[model samples]
Target: MSTDGVGFGVPWQVSAFQLPAEAPGAAELVTRIRELRARILFDGGRRPDFRDGEDYVDDQELDFGAWHFVGRREADGPPVGYVRLSTPQTGRLFQSRAFLGEGPFEDLLTEEGLGTAETFEHSRLVVEHRARKLGLGVHLNAMAIAAARCLGAKAMIGTSGTADGQDLFHERFGFRPVPGTRRYVERYTEDVVLMLYRAARGAGEYTALVEQLEPVFSTITVTPERALGDLPRAHGRAGSSAVTIPAPGADRRMDAEVWRPVLFEPQRAEDRGELDALLASGQVREVCDTIEEQLRELVRSREPGRKLAGAELERAVGEQLAGVDPASYGVWAWYPWSGRLVHLLPREEFRLVRTDRNRGRIERPQQRELMARRVGVIGLSVGSSAALTFAMEGIGGAFKLADFDDLSLSNLNRLRAGVHHMGLNKCVISARQMLEIDPWLDIEIYPAGLTDENMPEFFSGGHGPIDLLVEECDTPYVKIAAREHARRLGIPVVMDANDRGLLDVERFDLEPERPLLHGILGETTSADLLDLTFDQIVDLILTMVDRERISPELAASIPQIGKTLSSWPQLASGVALGGALTAEAARRILLGQPRPSGRFYTDLELLTRADRSTVA
Candidate 1:
C-alpha cells in the first residue's frame, strides 16, 4: 500500500472499484476491507476497527452498491487513499433528519422546503499519513463526490468530527454543517457536525464557483500585483500568511512570446543556447506544423482554387514571363517554397517597345518623342490625360506630373482608370498610368503639385527640371504661377483650356510676356479668378466661346454649361477633341514647328463654317 519513498518523477495510475454483487463474502471481501482498514490505520494513522462484522460492506452493498476509488503510484501499486459512498437512506443516517432534529421528510425534500430528494452518505475518507499533506484527502473526497453523482444520487450527507479537518470540508470545499444538529449526534460526540449537500444545490452553486475559478484553472494572470499601488506594502504586512501574489510586473508586462521582437533588443549569439535547445527538441517542429496547418486552412478558405505546386510550377511561371518585356512588365517573383514575393526590378527599368516603325525623318511629324523633350504637367486631370496620350504617342522622354489632389471618385468621370485607384495621389496615379503606357518614359512626380513651395524644385534644380510646363488646371493662379515660374526658370509652359469643342492653348514658353494669356484674359491671381463661383466661371467661359461661335452643335459640346451638359455623348466628343488639340499643341512644341507662341484656339464649330479663317 506504500510507494516506499519512490520519487515523484514517475507517473501514477488511478483506478475506480465497484462493489461485488450478492451477499458479502467474509473471507474475500472482508479481507479486502480489513486490508484497506489496516492501510488507513497503520499508514494513514486512523482508528483501527472503524467498521466491524462486515457492517460497512453489508450495508453499502445491499442498500446501494458502493464504489471505491484507488490511487496507486504505479500500475500495480496498492491504494494510497480511499472514500466510501452509500445509497439514499432515511432516518438517523440521513443528515437532513439528524440536522433538523424533526422534519416532515417529504416536505423537506421539496423546493417549498429543504429542496432535497434522494441523498447519499459520504464516509470513510482516509489517506496514508505520508500523502496526507500531498492532496490525497482532497483527491479521495473529490472521487467520492463524483462516484456519488455517477450513481444517480441527488444529494450527499455526512457528519464530520469536530476538529480542524471539519474546517477543511466546510471552508475549502464549501460544505456547511446543518442547523440544530448538536443533539442528534451526542451519542458519538457532542461536537459531531451534521452536513448535507443537495446535489441540485451543489450543481447550481458549483457552476458559479467554477466560473470564478475558471481564470485560475486556465492560468490566466490578470494585472500584476506590482502594477497595483500599495500591493507590496500589503504583502509585506501579511508576511507568510499573505496570499502568494504572482510576481510583480509578471502578468501585465508584455509577453516575450508575442512582443519580444518589437520591444526587446535582439539576443546575442552567446545567449541563444536555450533557444537553440528548444528548436533542437521537437517543440519547433510542433510549432511549425501548427502554423502550416493554420496557413493551409486560411489559404483554403480564401483562395481554394489557388494551388501551390513544386519546381515544375516555378518553371512554368518562368516560361510565362517569356516575351514579356522585363523592363516594361512589373515582374513579381513568388517563391513557392517560402511563400514570399519579390519585385525583380524597378518599374522604370522596362524599355518601351518602339511602335513607330519609321525611324527616318517624316515631314510635319505628329508623333514627338518624349525622350528628347521635357514636359511638365501642372495638374493631373487634363495633365494626366495629356501625359498618357504623350506616352502612348511614344513620346519617349521625361515627363513631369504635378498635382496636389489625390485620385478620387469624382475624377473618374473625365480621368482615366477607375475606383481601384481611388486613394492614390494624382501625381502618383498619373505617373503610374504613364509608366504603364511606356515604362521607359522618364517620370517625375511632384507630390505637392505646383505650389510656390515646390515650384523651384520642379522647374530649375533637382532631377529633371521642366522644359515645357503644361497648365491644364483650371486654377487661374496656377496658370499665372506656372507661366511666371517657367519664365523665371527659362522654361516654356503650355496649357489647354477645353471650352465646348474648343481647345485653347497658351504657349508661355514661346512668348513669355505677350501680356501672359491669363493677363490677356484680365485675370491676375489664380485664387482671385477661380474665386468666381463654378456657375460664374462656366458662364464666363461660355461667353468667351460663344463670342467666336461657328455653329450651335459645337457650342453645345463645350463643358462651359457645367452639369447641364450631363450627356455622355456630348462630353465624350468634347473630351476627344480637347485631347486631340492638346496633343497637337504638345507635338508642335516638342517638334519645334511653327505655332502660335502666345495663344491658339481650335473650334470644332468652325468645321461647319465656310469662314474657317475668321474663326481660327
Candidate 2:
C-alpha cells in the first residue's frame, strides 16, 4: 500500500488494495478514503439521503473483487485523491446495473461484443477541493486506468456524474457516453451518464498514460521521480484564492493576519516566480491597470505647464518607461481581504501624483510634511469616513484604526459601507477602504476596539508614535482615556460630534496641561467615567459639546433615546461634513498652523438659513 509512484512528473505515492484487505495499514487507509468521500461527496456536495457520518461506503465497496486506487502527495501523507476499479470477478453485479436495469446493461455490452471477463468499471473518483487545480484528478484517473490495463482488461466502463463537468473530464480520457443511458440519480441529485472505453479503439490521454506507465507497471519503486516528464503539464495553480482559506475553527480576527496587504517587489527572482504563480491562480478579482494613468500624472506633476494630449501623453509615458521592464517597473500591492492586486508607482512617485490636485491649497512642503505624520482613530462608524478622507488628502502615511463594534444595519445611515459589510468589524472595513485608496499606506487595525491594554500601542507602536489622534467612539471611558493618553504623549486630538457639525480640536502637543474636554469634566479620569450611569455619560458628552448649542433635531431626539429611538439621530450629510471638517483641521494642526484647541461649528441648518442678515 506504500507504493511510490510518479504521475505526470509530480512525485506521488500510489496505493491499491482489494476490499477486505488484511495487509497492515490497509484498513486505516480505506477508512481515511471513506471519510474524505463522505465529507466531500455526501456532505459538501449535497448528495441526498446521506446522514452526517464519519465515513461513506456503498455495497460496491464491500466486494472482494473491487480494488481501490489512492494517491498522496507524500509517502506518509493522508490520501488526497481516490478512484475505485471494479471487475466482473466480483460475485455482485456492477453498481450501474441497478440504474440501467440488467436487461439494458447486458444488451449494451452484447452490442459491443464485450465479454464480462474483459471489461471493468471505474467509479467513485474523488479529489480534495484544495488540490483539484493541481491535476490530482487526472493522476488518479491515470492510475486507475493503468492498473485496469495491467490486469489484462480490454474495456473500461463507469457511471460518471454529469454535474460539474465530471463526464467531460472523463471524455478527455477516451470515455464515450453509452447512448440512452443518461439519467438522474436521486442519491447524487444530478444526472449521471454511463461511459465506455474500449481497448481496440485506443485513444485519448489515457492511452498515452498507460503506455508511459508500462515500464514501471510491474515495479513498485518509481525511480528518478520525473518519469512522466514527457506528459503534458497540467494547467492552473493550486490554492490561488486571494483570500486564504482559513483552517477549521481558526480565529480570523487577528489584525495582523487578515487586514494587512503584502507587497511583491519584482527585484527578487523568487518574488517574480511567486507573483507569476499568484497571477495564474485566478484568485485576484481585479488587477488595477492604472499604472500608465498614474505614470501620465507623474509626468504632468513634474511639468505642470506641458499640454500633452491623446497619443502625445501616451508617447511621454512611453518615453519615461522606455528602459524599464514592464513587470519590474512598479511594485504590486496585494490586499488579501479584497483580493485586489494593485499596480502602483513606486511609493514616492505614487504620493506625488495622488496629491497633485492639492498643489495650490497644500503646497509641496506642507503636503510632504502632512504625509510624514501618523494618525490614530478610535470608533470606526464616523471614524471610517474620517480615515478614508485623511487617506485621500494624504494627511498621513501611516494610520492606527480601533473599533470593537461590528458594522450593523442601523449604522449604515451615516457610515460608508454596504450590506455585505454588515457583520465585519468596523476597524477592518475602515482599513480595507483606506488601503484601496492608497496601498502604500501603513495601516494597523484593532478589531477588538480601543482598550486600556492596546491604548499605548495604538498611540505608539513599532512604527513610532502617532502625531495626531481622532477620538470618535461613543464610549465615555474610551473618549476620556484616549484624550488622557494623547495629552501625556503630546499628540493632538480631533473629534467630530456629527451633530451641529461640531468639530473638536485639542492641541495636546502644544498644551499638555489642557484639562480633558476643556475642564467640562473637572478632575474626571477615564476610571471615573467608566463607572458612571448611562444617562450621566450622555450628559457628560452633551456638556462637553456645549448642550445649549445642540442642533434642534438632535435636541428633540435626545429624550427619545432608549424609548422611541434606539440611538442618537445622525444624517449622512452631517457625517460627510464631519469628515471634511476633521480632515481640514487635522491638516492645519499637523503642519503647525495656528488652529487652537476649541470647538468650531459649520451647522448647515444655520449656515443655510432662509432668512439670514449680516451681523455688524
Candidate 3:
C-alpha cells in the first residue's frame, strides 16, 4: 500500500491508497467506488445468479494490506473508475488463492517458475458505463501496473471475462492466456480466462504507458488538468487538435510508399544501405525461409518430361547449387506493411515454379504472354476477389487498383479482408493482398477512386496503357466515366453485377463506337450523371442492370433498401462467381479468343432449376 500523499490535480485525479485509508476523504471515496461497481455489475439484473441483494460486496474489499486506485473527474469528485492491486505481502491474494484453487495454482506457479513474492494481482476493474469510452479504464489499469512495479513486483496476473472480448483486449497488453483452463463464471454469465503478464513480454502500448506512469507515481504529485496528456483520446470523441499516435509499431496506415515491398539482392552492393536501415529500425518481425523448397521445385521444373531417382535428384540439385552463395542465391523481399522478410527464388525461376501447375490448360507460352500484360481494377469490394484471382492465376504481371471508400464492418461479407483492415482504403488493402501472393507483381493504387481528374492517368499512366479494365464501382458517374475512358483508350472492360452472376464485357478495342452497357443507357453520358440525386442514381443503376433480370432475392429486397436494409445485399457465392466470370472474360479477351462485347449470365438459379434437371 502506498503511503505517499500523491494525487493528480483538478480536471482528473488518479491516486492510490491502502485499504482502510487514513487520508482525508478516503472513506467517502471508497464508498463512491463501491457504489459505482455495484451499479455497473449488479443493476439491471446483470448478476441474476446472485440471490443476495443488489449491494455487491467482495470479501477482498476489507483486506488491510491491499491498495485501491481510484479515478475521478476532479480531485474530490465521485469515482468514475476503480482497480485493485493485491500484493503478495498482504498474506491474501485474489487470483492465486481464490480465483484459482490453491493446489492447481501452486502447480501453475511451479510450471512457470514464478515466485509469489515477486508477483502481484490486479483485479476487480470497474469503470462507469458512460465513462468507459473516456479511457478511464485504460488509465486505471495502467496505474495498477505502475503501482505494482513500483512496489518491486516483476509480474502481474488477473482474470478476464471473455464475453465482450475483454480477454482479447487484455492480450493486446501482453497478457498470456492459460491454455485449457477457461471456465464459465455464473455470476457474470461469461467464460473467464486466467492471464499472466511479464514485463519482458509487455506490448509496446502497455510498456509505454507503464513507463510514463511510473515516473508520475514516484514523484508523489502531478499538477495537470489531464495528468497523462499522452494517453489515447477518448473513443468516439472528436479531438480538439491533431494527435499523432506515439506508441511504436501501433501505426497501421498503409500508404503508397509502404505498400510496395522492398527487394534486396545480396549480390548487388547498392542494397546494403537499405538492408542495414531496415534492420536498424527493428521493424522486421518475421523472417521466412522457404527458398530450399523453391530450389528443389526449380530443379524438378527444369526437366519436366523426365523423372529422376532420389539420388539423381539430389545430385542435380547439388549441381545447380554448386558455388552459389546461399544468402545471394535468390532475393530477399521486405513487406513494410506486415513487417515480414521473405526469401524467394529469382524472378524467372520463381515464375516457372509458380505457374508450373498451369501447364497443359494454359501452356507455357500462353502463360508468359498473359503475365506480360497489365490489368486495371476499379471498386475493390467484388473487384478485390477478381484482382486476387488474377494474381493467383498469373493473368497479369502489373495491376492498377482504385477505390475511394475505406473498408467497413459491412464490407466483410464480400470483400477479402479481416476486421483489423477496417478503416483502411480498399485500394491499399487489395494491393497489399495481391503483393503478398506474388511479390514480383507491379501494382499501383488510386485510393481516391476513379475521378474525372485522374481518369486519364488511371487508363494510361506510367509504363503505358492497361491492356484490360475491370470496372465494378457503384457510383454512377465513375462507372460511366471509366467506360468512356476505356472506350477512348481502346481498352477492353469487364464487370460483374454480382446478381445471378451477370457478367458484362465491352471490347471497346474492337468496337470503338459501341454505346456503354451495350446501348442500355441510351446516351446517358457521365457528365449528365455527375450531379444526380441519390434516388435518381438508384433508378438509373436499376435501369442499366435491367431490374427484370436481377435475382429474385435481390429484386424482392430492393423496396426495403433504407427502411429495413442498409444497402443492397451480396453473398460470398455471388461475389466468388463474379470473380471467376470476370477473370474468364478478361483471359479470353487478352488472349485474342474473340469474345465480343455483350452481357452474359451464368445464373445458377436458372441453370440448376429442379424442374429443368431430372437426369438422376
Best-performing candidate as measured by TM-score = 2
Q: All candidates: CA RMSD in angstroms?
A: 30.9, 17.9, 21.3
| Model 2 accuracy (lDDT, Cα) | 0.73
lDDT scores in order: 0.47, 0.73, 0.72
lDDT of 2 at 109: 83
Worst 10 residues of 2 by lDDT: 231-240
Ranking by lDDT: 2, 3, 1
Ranking by TM-score: 2, 3, 1
lDDT of 3 by residue, 1-616 (tens): 1221112111346766675456555554455445545555542333433224534443344334577676765555555566778888753556545668888777777788888887788777876542333356667777788777788877887888764456766776687788867776656654578998886665445677776777777553332222222322222221111111111233343122245566677666645554564555466788897887788798888896668658887787778778786667777777766678888898888899999998877888999999999999999999998999999888999898888888999999888888878888888888888888888787777776776655676687533469999999999988998998989889999999999889999999999999998999898888898788878977888998998898889888888888899998999889999999999899899898978888899999889998888796
TM-score-superior candidate, 2 or 3: 2
Off by over 4 Å in 1: 1-352, 358-369, 522-570, 598-616
Q: Write the residue-wise lDDT of candidate 2 on 48-121 in tens digits.
A: 24323323444334444477766676665555677888877851467776678888888878998988888888
Candidate 3 Cα deviation (angstroms), residue 249 = 3.0
Residues 97-182 of candidate 1: C-alpha lDDT, one tens digit per residue = 54455554444456334333356777656554323323345445654565566556666767675422343343344466666553
Candidate 3 similarity to native, TM-score: 0.59
